[model samples]
Target: MPSGKGQGEPFKLEPFQKLFIRAVYEPQLKLRRVVRRAILSMARKNGKTALIAAIVLAHLVGPEAIVHGEIYSAANDRDQAAIVYKFARQMVDLDPELGQMIELVPSTKTMIARRTGSVYRAISAEAGTKHGYLPSLVIYDELAQAKNRDLYDVLDTSFGARDEPLFIVISTQSNDPEHIMSKLIDDGISGVDPAIVCHLYAADEECELGDEKQWHKANPALAKFRDYEDLATSIRKAIRMPAEEPKVRNLFLNQRVSPHASLISRAEWKACAGESKLQDGEEVYLSLDLSSTVDLTALMIGSVSDPCRIEPHFWKPRDKLIEHSSRDFGSGSHRYREWAEAGRLHDSPGKTINPEAVALFIAEMSQRYRIKGMAYDRWHMDYILREFDRIGLQAYEDCEKGGDGLRLVPWGQGYRDMGPAIDALELAVIERQLIHPNNPVLNWNMANAVATSDPAGNRKLDKDKARFRIDGAVALSMLLGLRARDRNIKPVDIEALIG
Candidate 1:
């Protein structure tokens, strides 16, 4: 007997639930959008479906609602769409009050409001299904897994017709930075809105990777629905030997797991550095890493003609890298700020650099050499995107969807394929197929890299995951692989493009 003043008792709201109700009903709230985003991040199995069902019932039966009102619940897959429908059905079955308010068409998995003639339908996101319906409210579930993402375009078109239409998108975090769900989460968190969006997420940066206590925060239902002790044991086993990437990321961190672990140790990766300068007639491929902190900004180039060989063209530590460091750097006793003042290395202009200046540098250098393509992680690299857009530089955007024209090479698979690439490079060096002018800084950076693997057997550098990272070693490898893949170079490319 859940306590409620209705014909059939209503479900009790949690602390977060009360907060969510206020977000939904209080139009006077100035920060309604912000509050809603917070609600979106509530842990899974915290009665999400029940809450949604209750909201639907109110819209259908409440006196203020419009007649023949349309509501839609959408998920990335048909199976997931059924889950929400099941909740609505269960509510109708359990509660005598809610049951009287609606007529369920069980065959179609739809609910029809008797007085208002409103309808609620469960929809799976398909290529163009959303285009035909003018829904008063639409729920997007598991948006991260949407196969085509055409639902976004259709929803955009439909939204213009209704003044007070409600849109809700909920999904677990996904690894693909390009995913539509991820974009929504990012936009919601940044307070970018015409649509009110909300997100709930694990505090990834603050939480220990495999700590069970921390895991429970993001998965509140672990004790009730899952075996908490078993989960803890599994996590412990994952990191114990070979350092499994999947169990660490997926189970604990709630991030997409990298597919494979590396054959080579991080220490071994650190030993594979070579020179930076390109030999005569050698075509180069560039990979860039834009600095977020006063971190290192690197541009690594690899020779495409000889798959086994790679070289670094640029490695500049932003003025901030060593600015606060307690360690001494050789005879140059002056601080990192001193290097910036002397114009020896580029310093961050302030919190960020002038996009135009950065663009000009890339474009100018690109023109000066026979570069195939520039590959970079777009995460936290918006400055680069804007700069490239402004400068008329050819860049790959929406590459997975075939809009960008430039080929997109995936990482994570790099570690698995690096051994072959390394062998090829070694052979190239012996055969004189590869040649370079030695650059000590590039060599130094390469000597500091580490490698790790995922369950799928893909491999990537552990530098991003490690406490100590090399200057630009990871970036160098990325550029080399990108160039090779772009050229359709055989036998030496990372397996991600093929498989």
Candidate 2:
């Protein structure tokens, strides 16, 4: 049924598909095209496999063929890997000309063109340690589902000897924005590299779930590829089952939402973003989130002024920056590299954040800015306090600076304390009162943040099910919480939010 083998309707390229092909294959002043990679991403049931089959056929024996060229269609598993192969095989069988030239070997999930001696094989991530294959073109299907990037790295590197190698990735999005596919999609969408061609067809995240008008954004083949009545049935079922909403959004709308939701929406956080930053001699309140040695450690500095201007000092081990971004788990594929290049992220020496460096940095900030002392979690305050002593900067335990020394106030991480902090940040965002340098790291943390609440409706930042590091946002909120508390500005009514 997936192959549509007996369907009388001929396989033809849609306008969208044709445009993608032209962008990928069309040459410029030179004979070879500029693009080395093409990413075609959309929702399911979009005739992706059929379009892929056509491209495979063209390269195997038709217009794009070359002698002994090796082509591979890869997926996360064998079953998915064989899809394009099966489609191409059935198409070959339908035409006498193709049947005469192409040899189908179902057992191996391979097709060979007799005329050109070119070979196409279906491979998957399970087939690890693939080596010594000179690939002219590698088609990765649903690459976002891969458990790791090993298979992709191998196949990509194998194209080293080819003159004009092309790597084609066709898939939906990954819920984790750090996945390799997600990174590629972001880069492609950003147009960071002109050598990469990307075509994405997906509905907006805020689009009405069952709205038929918005369906075409994600499904270019809505009517021609599948019966509209059947799609409507699926939509109706999903609407009735609230639990099925995530599935519908992920699979049908092609959104990046996972099982857990973000604490603050991107639009909400972006709304409060400003170019405002810390000023010399400006009164500053600080929050220090000292994470583990290998994790991110953040410091948020903000003024108590009406339009609360803020800045951050975020540090990670210089050595682990790239490794952190490329990991399969925990905030993989973040734009750490880009942020680092832009001087937005600070790199500490070696493989761990130096507490002495952090303490020294704090002392330095005190010289330029008047202090309201720094709020800190007790989790790793000893390390920082010890560093302060080593640098001859006395870290006082009071809220305001005492005897020209640094003030370190305790900020608990539990709901009892963080509940107000969370409320304060939310209120500031709603009122457009907080301003920051629009730091990418802070923005990312805010987007990944999620909140958990107690029976009394007291809430705290939930890192357990959160997308990734939320230290910066937590710290930002703590400073805002302190501002409201110290200034006796009436706190956000927790009962109102709870009620």
Candidate 3:
């Protein structure tokens, strides 16, 4: 079997592997084996399959063997399930003494320890019919990749009749937090069940992307068995391409981050954070995005200058704020209440965000800063227009018709209008030409936001397709769009306005 040091050699357990074995198998206080289940998680290339193979050998023909013992390696699919069986077959083939003792049946991917009368086989959720078999030992490979908990439940329940049944799950962390493997990892760490043992090797979410020291936390076999330079190259690529970062962090760093589908990486969004307080007298572009009664509403005001300073305003109804915040919409992805208490998110008074309150806030801001222009989705602003009129915020067709009247730019949410603006925002972020108040709500919106691109490589944010609420990001993009289109914005005179 292959290992980090070299391939085609007898698989040997490392120090960490031995420690994990001890924790899983060692008996304590009247129990023959303390742990009924063991979960081992780490970054890829840590020789998990090899370790799984070794465990199978230990239980099947080694000291733990029992007559008529049934050992199975389970995976999401047949190909994956066959991995451990292949490795075990190689081990038995290489050893002359073991070759005399074990019978191999390649047709069904099964092995029989001749002396002990133990049976081992590879099974998958796809092969069909997983019921009626009592398993002595089950090693589940990459449980994170499983579509649902059906196979896991079957394997878990199958162990009931055995004397010392062991269920071992070995895999890298899944990108999704809601996966069964994720729950097992969490429960293992929480120490909820004394019978469940967990050995997780993963870097923290805040660990720097390029830190080799931090990389070792997730990759226990780094440099020893795994190639160090190969990992370094991957990290460099992740840093250069922000879109690949989520996968890199999830796969290599063993972090529970979203995969490649994320429109913006966490690192890219974080680099743009700052105290982006728009100067009191600066001419800033204003944009709005309205959400459903159950969702968020956003107002973004920002300077068009370099290092684009932005102050984002978010509102949710007071009644549903706590309830929405508590739900794991993305499975602990959002912390709306925490952000609200920190003075970042504003709470609307009633069950829904009132358009009058939004318009009045705009009118109040116009008192201090000159409303250079306002951009909004044309389809949803009809009701808000009456609120604008009631609050004395007059709308002008263009800057030419605007004499102290707000130039209302009707922005469409289609690719034709939004594609170029999205490009500008992406470029600004990459170039470090944008700054924000380090608002968590805004950051969360951007993190949750995903984009749909055209054949021409023009990409626009799709709120419908996003994993979570993206109101702030949509508003910010519209603000950037207005900032790009209009440049004749006049700065405000604060003292004169007050006088």
Candidate 4:
């Protein structure tokens, strides 16, 4: 019974809460429980904390209690972990029977049963000292916000020691599709594991944002615990501001929208992808965006003809490839390793990028294509420039004259330069005038791209605002800018024409 609201009263469980309790407690046979793992996904402000608190209390001292049983509720941070603990403590204080039977220690965030030696503790991911506990029930609150999978993996696998362990993951949908929580939800939905039960409350993909029916679909507590007036205000804000729509849909509609603000719509970008392949010995312009050893570096090549055909090359360090790939870099670096295995990406040795390998690849590419010009950001290009010189390629500034050979041109990445370039690329994608080989690396980068506008209304792709690497998009934009200025090819002033 919960007692904090007014007086020590019997805890009133909602229909959804009752259903969840039955799902957790109902036995398959005489003593065996049906569900070993339960995934509860819903929108925000849906009484998730209160329900989890009740379940924690039930495990600690109620009929589910076992002798010396250990129960844990974990979150990404200390404050989040304390949320459930605080609510449970309030419930204990409000009820006389619970207050007498439970001993609450606020300092350590632990509650112990007086008769039974069962204990409940709240822990955070940062406290990497959770190795010894053999938990009977583990409640993972807001699993979507977890930074990595270390704590989850440790706790999940440690349940093997218990006879009937229950792992309950209650979370909102993460904006990042590659997040561990998202992956777990996907696996749960596959229904391969009968012991795992998944309850997902989300709006349909075709449902329009701010639709009342869609809102009701995602939020079970719409008129019960959740206030309709507050949701209506949020809907108004989301509909009025285009930038806030994705976040609103993600948090309220339970949609898997991109974490970062997107520069291009996914549908438009997908529409532009085709089976068009770049021909050998074709006249092409190239652009390079170099990064330090630990980050991603990209080289994008494209023909200056109509329906520009683009190809990309990416490189990353080889050391700890698996570990780095598993980390959530919005889209996850696993895609990088996958591309490398497919021979589409270059995995350089050690922790830093190998400039020699990059130069070698460019030199080889120069042999295949009549490389007219190469645009590169001036930052961190000293080693690459020296490597180009070693390969008998000349480095030229935008203002400098060059011979009829492969020339490296210094390209500015500021709004004045990148604004027109991004605008041009967007126009090409929307008009279906650009032909790409449907490179997954480039597609991921494009999905991660976010645009920021200056006071003068000129916009450029902002890397800091983006959730993942946008090097491919940046390189392609630079190449497009250079191609637009070339006298040999008829330039399309896409912005001017559209305006």
Best by lDDT: 4
Q: For candidate 3, lDDT tens digit of each residue in 9-105?
A: 7677788899899998875657577789999999988888888888888888898899999998888898787777787788888788888988999
Q: Sort by lDDT, best first: what order?
A: 4, 2, 3, 1
What TM-score, computed on C-alpha atoms, does each candidate reach? 0.52, 0.87, 0.60, 0.78
Poorly placed runs, candidate 1 (over 4 Å): 1-10, 29-39, 42-44, 62-64, 126-130, 192-195, 220-248, 251-253, 256-475, 478-499
- How many clashing pairs per prediction, in order? 18, 1, 1, 2
Which of the two candidates, 3 or 4, achieves a greater lDDT against the reference?
A: 4
Candidates 2 and 4 compared by lDDT, better number:
4
**Candidate 4 overall Cα lDDT vs. reference?**
0.81
The models' CA-based lDDT, in order, is 0.55, 0.81, 0.80, 0.81
How are the candidates ranked when ordered by TM-score, highest leading?
2, 4, 3, 1
Worst 10-residue lDDT window for candidate 4 reads: 327-336
- Could you give candidate 1's per-residue lDDT for residues 235-318 as a string of tens digits? 677667545754455434455322233222222333443454556545666666665444556666666764335555432344
The ten-residue window of minimal lDDT in model 2 covers: 328-337
lDDT of 1 at 54: 62
**Alpha-carbon shift of residue 237 in model 2 (angstroms):** 5.5
- Among these predictions, the greatest TM-score belongs to 2
